[model samples]
Target: MMTKTKLPNKKLAIPKKKIAPKFRDAFIRFYRYMIFFGGRGGSKSTHIAILLLSRMMTDEYMYLVYCRKWSAHIKDSQFKIFQDCVKMMGWQDEFKFNQSDYSFVCLRNGNRAVAKGLDDNQKTKSIAEPTHIWVEEADQMTFDDFDTLNKALRSLKTQNSFILSFNTFINELHWIRTTIFDKEQQYELSEQFRNMDTYLNHSTYLDNPFINQEEYLQTLLMDNGGNESKIASDRYGLWGQMPNENPWLYAFDKEKHVRVIPFIPSYPIYLSFDFNKNPMTVKMFQMSPQKGLYDSFVHMIDEMEGTVVLREFCERIKAKYPFSPFFVTGDSSGQKKGEVGYESKHDSAYSMIKKHLGLSDKQMNPNGYNLTYENSRILMNQMFYNYPNLYIHPQCKVTINECEIATVDEKSMNVHELKKDRGTYAMDHFDNMRYFFQKYFQEFARSNYHATK
Candidate 1:
C-alpha cells in the first residue's frame, strides 16, 4: 500500500453541488447493510466516498475499514478515488494521510479511515472492531468471505452499517443475487440475519446527475453496433443478460435458451465429464419428454481428485434427484488407466462414474460419438438453431457463463484456449457439455432420420 497527502495547515471551504433527490434518503438513513449495485458511472463509489469523508469530519468516534477484492487495487483505484473526493470536497488541508498504514486521520478529531484488501489476511486482521466497512467490487467475493466480514462487523460497538458496491455480472446464481436481489430468498435471509436492515439500491449512468451525457451517448452508440449487454450495463445500468465477445458458443441467448424448467424423473440424467486433476467438471443433461430436446441444468466443478470427485457427484445427485436414473458420458481420455490402482480395479473416470452411480454399460455413452472438433462445433450450432428445444436453467450460472462468455483464440481458432483478455478457469464446464452434446445430438439426428424414412 502507498499513500500521499497535501495538507496546508488550514481548513478549506467545501463546494456545494446540487444533490439528486434519489440520493437524499440514502444519505440520511442508517441501515445495517447498505448495497449500491448497478452499472458503471452510477456515482455509487462517489456518493459513498462523500458520505465516509463527511462522517469522519463531523463525528469524533467514526472509524472505517474500506476494502477491495485485491489489496493492490486499493492504491490504484479506490484510494485514488477517495483522494480525489477529499480534494473535491476541499478537505485536503484538514486530513493527515499515512502511507505506511494506508489510512487517513482527521486532524481535528483524531478519527481514522483505513484502506485494505479483503484478500490480504494481514490487513483484515488489523481491522479490529471497525464500525463501518465498505467492500468495493463486492461481486468478486464468495459467500463464505461475505459471512466472515458480516460476523466481524456485527461484533463491533460503534458503527451500525456495512456497505457493499458492485456491478452485476451475468451469473444470476452469485451469492449476492441469491441472498440480496431475489425476493423469495429475502424471507430466508431475514430469518438468518436478524436485526439487520438490509437495503438494496440500484442505479445507472442515466440516473447519475454528474455523468457527462454527451460523452456517454457517444460511447453507447459505439457499443450499440453489436454489444447489447455493454449498452445495457454501462449506459443504462441494468443487469443485462450477457456480453458475447468473440463467442465460441455463439447460439446461446438469454431470451431463447435460459429459463426455469422442471426436471423429469422418468428421463435418465446424462452426466458428461471433463477430467482435469485440479478442476474436474461434470455437466448434467436430460432430454425433455414433452419438449423433445435436451435440458442441461446442473454443473459440478470440483477441486478433489479421482474417486473422491465421483463420490461427491454421486452424493449430490442422490440428494437432488433420489429416484432418477444416472447415465454417464465424457471425453474419450477418461477411458485410460490411472496410476492409483491400489483403491479399485477400475481406475478410469468413466468406470468410477459407473461404479459409484451404479450405472451399467447401457447407462453409459462411452466414447461419446468421438466427433472431431469441427464436427462437434457444427453439431452444437445445429442444436442451438432449434432454440425452443434446447434450454439451460438459471441455476447453472457457471455453465451459462462459460457458454456465453467463452471466446475464440485469434491464432488457433480454438474456443478453449485461454486468452489474456479473457481469464482462465472458465471453459471447463463448457467442455463437459461438448462431450454430452456430441453423443446426444448424434442419437437425436439418427432417430429423427429413421422416423422420416
Candidate 2:
C-alpha cells in the first residue's frame, strides 16, 4: 500500500506593499476583460498571477483558467510563473499542486487554478465553469480560439472576467484590431463581449522602476539595424508596421529624402502628365543645374488634376501657374490617336493640351516619349536614394503617401499593381514625377562631374 499525504488548508495573505502602483487596481477591479499589451519586462504576467491568487483565496467557488496556445508550453511558462508568484507571496503551503493534472488547488477554499493548453480539445471540454480566465502570449492564439473560449465562459453560471496579455511583436495580419476591436465589426463585438467592458493598458520597461537600464541599452545596441518598426514595437510599447519588403519606391525614406522648399517663380516649372478618364494626374518639378546630384535638390512644388476633360485640366494649370514658364514631358501615349475632347481621333491628348495651355513645341521635353516604365522606376528609385536629390513641398500630401506605401506583388514580382486600390489615381502622380526626372535631370550627375573636371 502507498502512503498519501493531504495538503494543509490555509488562505493566502499577501502584503499590501508588494503590489506595484501600475497593478494596484488588478487586485480590486473585476472587469469583464482586461488587456495588458506592450513590450517585455513589464511584469504583466506577475501582477496578473498575484491577482488570480487573491481571487481564489476570497471566492471558494472560483475556478481560474490559465490558458496558452500549446499544452507543452503551459508547464514551462504560465504554470511556473504562477507558482513563483505563490511562493513569493509566502503562500506555498496554502496551495496544493497536482503535477499530473497540471493544477493548483486552494487548501482553505475549493477554488482551483487550472493550466490549459488550448491546442488540446479535451482540456477545453474539462473546464466546467470558470470564474476568471487568463490567456498568456495571446498573439499566438487565433481569433477563432478567442471566440470558442468566450462561448465556453457564457455556459458558466457565474459572473466571469477575462485577462489577455501579449507582446506587440506579431504580424499586422494577426493584430487584435483586425479581429475583436474593429469599429466596423462593432455589432459582432458587442454581441460577443456583452456589456463589452474592456480595460486597456500598455506597459514598457521604463514603466517598471526596477528595470536595469544598462541591460536594455545593450540589447538595443545588439538589435540596431534599419528595422525602425521592430525597435518602436519592442522599446516604446507602440503599434508598429513592418517595412514593406517589396515597396514600389524602396528608396523613399521620409526622414532622409523629404524636404520642404518654396516654389520660385524665376525658375521654369517642369511638368509631367498622365492621362486617364476618371482622374488625370500632373506633377510640377524644377531642377538645380549648378549643383551635383548628391548636393542638388529636385523641388516638386505642386500637383493639379481632376476628372474633367483635358481642356479643363489644362485651363486649371494655366490659371494656377499663370506667370511661371512651363516645360512639359509625358508619356508617348498622350500623342497617340485618340479623341480626348475633339470630333476625330487625330485630335490627340497632346494636341488638345498644347492648344488649350498655349504651350509651344519647343517647350516640351520629347526624350520621355519612348521611356519604358521599368527604366523610369529604376531612375526614380536611384535618384531618390543614391543621388538623394528629390524634395517635395509639405502641401503635396497625396503624392507623399502614395510614394511611401505603394507595394509590388510578390508572385508576379512587379510594381504596376499596388496592394491597395489607388483611389483617386494618386499613384499616377508618382509615375509622372519619375517621368519628369528621367526626361530632364537623369544624367545630371555625370554631366556635372565632366563639366567641373
Pick by TM-score: which candidate is best?
A: 1
Backbone clashes per model, in order?
Answer: 0, 0
What does candidate 2's lDDT look like per residue over 224-271, in tens digits? Answer: 574777777777766665566678777788877567887888898888
In candidate 1, which residue pairs clash? none
Q: Name the top lDDT candidate.
A: 2
Candidate 2 matches the true fold with a TM-score of 0.49
RMSD of candidates 1 onward, in order: 8.5, 14.0
Model 2 residue 346 lDDT score: 77
The lDDT for every candidate, in the order shown, is 0.66, 0.70
TM-score of each: 0.63, 0.49
Angstrom error of the Cα, residue 312, model 2: value is 43
